[model samples]
Target: MREHRGFEALGQAVALAEPPLIESSARTDVGVHRRVNEDAVFADGGVYVVADGMGGHEAGDLASAAAIEPFRALAAAHGARDYRMVEATIELARRAVDTVSLRTERGAGCTLTGVVLIEHGGIPHWYVMNVGDSRVYLHSGAELTQLTVDHSLHAELLAEGRAEAADTPRNVITRALGSGDSRHDAWLLPVHAGGASWCALTG
Candidate 1:
């Protein structure tokens, strides 16, 4: 997996073996304020995560970097072979972002998403999680599926049939890191076979 950083966005990539290293990328952006992107690799019931940060006047970069640092440390200490650890690492990122006190402005924040690769009795599986518009998609044979649902005002509107796909709210995320300390949300997704591959896309 890899993490890419930019002035306004963050990106991640993962390579799968059985899936033949299918081309996939995940990204998240907190508009002109912040962004984070993360990815994971699956093989032999293991996962790897990479988170990129992009927020803060001085703290935006710190927030993004801080979001991933703890997860990386946890992964290094405990390894991604355990699914529970994957979830823990995610929460850790959320908490890490929260711990970063905002210097000025409305506060520091970031977007995050990741995947966990696992195998149960020889069956390969994937577990996905996200907070914000960072996305996860699955492609099986000829059909592509969205594994992780987006958490944004636009998504809420889409769910209520009040908005079109092209009319989505611009970077209006309903949830994310450092948004607050009271609420936290994420998704647990399983990857299935039958010519299926997964991708996480965000705009």
Candidate 2:
């Protein structure tokens, strides 16, 4: 499984006139069974991403690196404030992963989950995206809300009432970069005071 750990200080602190500054910490591990960590994270230029390479695929680490490379460029070039640009950025990452798959001759892919901090009319908002089973969550005043849905067989089975949660295997994802049509889910969340958000990308 892929995991991340770090700390971030976001937003502005201007004498209490602005919204409270946000601070975050994240940590990642390769787990006991895996020899290498096939995960990538980008938390700069207002773009935060966590990508998990698909296990059992050759060059899984390369696949994840390819998926995140474009976002690094996106953050450097256009930043993450533009919603249209963020969408296009994801598409670019997908194509990069596809290129890796074509060259390796082995089905390679990764799960991507991230949030971009943007502004609309001077108000901050979060543009969240998900592919495969990575997740985003919001924490607010004793409430933890799941912000993205998992695209996984286990999730489907649970939704269809064909399996119980305890009996389902968690690693089987239904969608990913370099697989199928490469579609992804997205959301726009208005940032508010007294709350924070986090994400997890696991394969």
Tell me, by TM-score, which candidate is best: 2
Report each candidate's C-alpha RMSD, comma-separated, in the order given. 9.3, 6.8
lDDT of 1 by residue, 166-200 (tens): 57755677666777431334333443333356555
> Candidate 2's residue-wise lDDT over 29-56, tens digit each?
7789789888877777667888889987
**Each candidate: what lDDT?**
0.52, 0.74
Residue 149's lDDT within candidate 1 is: 57
Query: Candidate 2 versus the native: TM-score?
Result: 0.81
Off by over 4 Å in 2: 1-20, 78-80, 164-168
Can you tell me which runs of candidate 1 are displaced by over 4 Å?
1-58, 77-80, 119-124, 163-168, 181-195
User: What does the lDDT come to for candidate 1?
Assistant: 0.52
Error of 1 at 128 (Å): 0.7
